[model samples]
Target: MRSVYMQSLAYVDANRIYSRIMELGEIGRTKQSGVQRLALSKEDKEAQILVTKWMEEAGLTVSHDHFGNLIGRKEGEKPHLPIVMIGSHIDSVRNGGKFDGIIGVLGGIEIAQFIYSNNISHAHTLEVIAFCEEEGSQFNDGLFGSRGMVGKATEEDFQKKNDQQVTRFDALKNFGSEIDPARYKESVRKEEEIKIYLEMHIEQGPYLDVNSHPVGIVNGIAGLSWYTIMIEGTPGHAGTVPMNLRNDPMIGAAKVIQEINEICSSQPDQQTVGTVGIIQAFPGGSNIIPNAVQFSLDLRDINLTRKNRIFAEIEERLQAICQENGLSYTIKTNIELDPVACSEEIIDVFTSIGKKLDMDIPIMVSGAGHDAMLMSEITDIGMIFVRCKKGISHQPEESATKEDIAMGTEIMLQAVLQYI
Candidate 1:
């Protein structure tokens, strides 16, 4: 099939798009004028209801998967063809900004809404989704919905617990999801079922904001490796155990954690980054020595070779640190993936449209993680980024102009229509 060429965009209701974004924000409005709609929370349910209403009004047939991802379908002239999928998550962090994931969903809906209202003829069906728990703030695991959709979610994902001591299993049940937690494989969409995937999101960094570009094309998302390192040592009384004689896991953990920073920073301009997001020491007492220490390391980089070498160096140093401190250790690789490149075909469409629109579209490699990365496992993926103020995101101050978002939507609309 060939793309349907359009000399101009049929229409994109910028006002309606902005209004919907603000409307969704009102559901979990925080004192800081942000959103706290964690996945499966009450606020998330409220937002889902409102979004569902909007989807129906936009002429979509909406339904919920067993995982609770809100999916909306718009049938095309040819319904059996692999679908063109677009959208992002609606669930936000504890106090996230209004536009992070909201733009992609609303933008995709606007495209679908336009196609339906204008009665535009297309050969492939269009699908929009507001994936559940992309923020993962509730269950301490992000990308739950996207991963589930792609069959990448692991057994450890659904078993994770929240701060309230509630397992994800119970939380999904409370939220009206038909998930068994043990076996929710029905939600996975086969690679052949999707033609391509697209998403629009805030830059979440200052590149575009600093360059004063309203919209940017994402070249790719960085690869990431997550490791849970455990250090074990003999427990003893802090007062009685001399520092020279004690086998201390905390000492080993501290040394390894510090090395993680130094190793990733070795190549400063390479964009290699490593962070220890979590740390825990057992026998939490001022007078007691920790018997074990557990910590999480998140390493990411656009260059896979650099990322791997850095991780290897960290592990090498970790072994030395453990041996020096008389501690035994284990490393659990929770997740590891190579960088995902955007679909060059879809990317060319965006760039052409941007040039036609007289917009300067910057191509950037994402340093942060995104659901688009997982979609890469199944289908061609493309991402458009709208500039947020100062590149701030995941907080109350995260801001993206309605005009920028509309501009990105217009580009997406034109580009997606080409595929039809």
Candidate 2:
């Protein structure tokens, strides 16, 4: 294939990208054609193996860090200079869409492949990463790999459990990971080591599609928080226990979950949103009053102060509701991230490149958390959003046109060229 450039404008073979996407999507495919490739699972490992092979085919040296992050690097003339990094996560949520995070990884690899095959020269080392556990679908603390890379993930974070009652620590161990609490820093990248982070992803929202734009420049990412709610009560026979005399933890959990919806909907900021991902009741029998209940809450907002303030009210409401139900509960915060803005300088670069390519690049906001969010801790970050069909994501129906994928990939390539 020829280099994807016409007089310095970015271009690439979208068929190659789409073909690889379909190949990878075959792994962990659900009956509905969605993906069930949770982090640290066999499927996730299988994905790593396949993508690693592709990385090698692109003539990049590949390495896996202690945190399970896959890094593919090609040294530049000035190898000592901070690297230009590109990528997104490969892990998927249960029954997730095929194009959500897959395009970014494949697109990044295509860029490296182009650089290698065309013998493009640059001054800074180029790296492409496949970050692990960004979905947090299994472990519940998302961005585990990126967090670890920046020294933000802790031993406790690795020890988190999934709905199957499997601790992530044990899962990682079973998946062939040798994690030592003391050695976590080994995966960390110092601020000076990273010049900037670039990610290409499906918009996961309707903005670009509805606006009839093929690609978007992300200006900011919404702040998000994940919490686990554990409620305790006395278990009793459903038939024998009178409603007034029984302490039902399930009842308490219901109230708190409902209040989350109520509070988020009532918030003056329409962007504030909350969702319950998983809920489990102990002694889950039709005839038994639940003695324990555990559930997770996902809350997001672009406004930090307002989100925090709303969370406080929700906390008090949880306490009051639990007391009313004659129950006790604890809400443990799993992860909390403040809103992060993309680098303005990089945004300008993208805008300028878009103009040069004669492509309309819409500026937008990302409501989802990404590896790019955590990478912002160590360096400037930028993102390219491809328009997905109907702006749908995280579902089997999630999709993006090849044209949009090509547009987004070109933006990523141009950004890399500018940085290098």
Candidate 3:
């Protein structure tokens, strides 16, 4: 079938989009003005229900899978053609800002509403999805909904437990999802059915704001490796133990963290980063020497080879530090994701549209992972980023101006029109 040419242009209602964003924020609103709609929780379910309602109001047919991924589809002029999927997740990290995942879903809905109201028919069907559990804040399973949609999820994933000691199976039950394994397979869409996937999100970093760019075109998503390290040592009285003689595991942990920072910084490419986000020293007391220390290591880089090499060096240096400190250590790797590159064709489309619209659109790599990375496994994917204040995200202070969001939505609308 031949692709549909652009017949007319449509505009997005920025006020409506912003209003929906604020409405979704209220479901899991935090005292700090952030959101805490963890996946499969009551807040998340409410957010999903509200979004589904909006999707229906937009004149789209809504459906959900066993994994609870909500999909709203608007038929195209050529129903047999593949679909153009546009959306992001609704779930948020603990105390996450309002725009992280909310914009993509709502932005897609606004675009759909525009098209429906204008009676502009495209060549392929348009689908907006509010994915479940993209933050992994609740179950430690990032991209849970996207993975299931792409056939990358397993039964074991459903059986995983959360902090409250509740399994995903039970959580889904509580959220009122139908848990039939046989029918769950229907949730996975065939790759051939989807022509392209588009997502819009906040820059979540300082790049766009510092450079004074209103929108960012993502070229790639960085790969990530997560490791938990535990050090064992003898606990003793802090006052009685000599500094040189004390076998404190905290010392070993400190040394490892310092070396990791140094190693990552030493790399020629400054894109590689290593962070020790979580740390715990057991037998905690001012007078007691800590006997055990546990810390989490997060490594990210667009280059997989360099990322792995850096991880290897960190492990080696950590082992040496433990040996010298007379401490035994164990390392456990929890998650590893390879980098995903965006579609060059889609990038070119966005660039061409930006130039035509007289906008400054710079292409950049994503430091944080998103559902777009998972969607890349099945179809060509592209991402548009709106500048956030100080590049702050995953917190209450995260924000983007109405003008920036409107500019982003305009670009996205034009790009979809041109591509479809």
What is the Å distance of residue 94 in model 2 from its true position?
A: 1.3
**Could you give candidate 1's per-residue lDDT for residues 132-170 as a string of tens digits?**
888768876678888888998877777789899887877
Model 3: how far residue 371 lies from native, Å: 0.7
Which regions of candidate 1 deviate over 4 angstroms? 1-5, 177-183, 236-240
Cα lDDT for residue 276, model 3? 90
What candidate 3 gets wrong by more than 4 Å, as runs, is 1-10, 179-183, 235-245, 282-291
Best of the two (2, 3) by TM-score? 2
Clashes of 2: 1
lDDT of 3 by residue, 1-420 (tens): 323345333377878899888888899999998999999888988888899899998888997777778889999878888899998999999988899988999999988887787677687899998887888888875888888888888888888899889988778666754545446678788889999999999999999999999999999999987788999999999889899998999989999999999999998868999999789989788788898999988899999998988888998998899889899999987677899999999999889878777776899999998889889889999999999999999999999987788888887887787666
Worst 10 residues of 3 by lDDT: 1-10
Residue 409 CA displacement from its true place in model 1, Å: 1.1
Q: If scored against the real structure, what TM-score would every candidate get?
A: 0.92, 0.94, 0.92
Candidate 3 matches the true fold with a TM-score of: 0.92
Q: How good is model 1 by TM-score?
A: 0.92
lDDT value for candidate 3?
A: 0.87
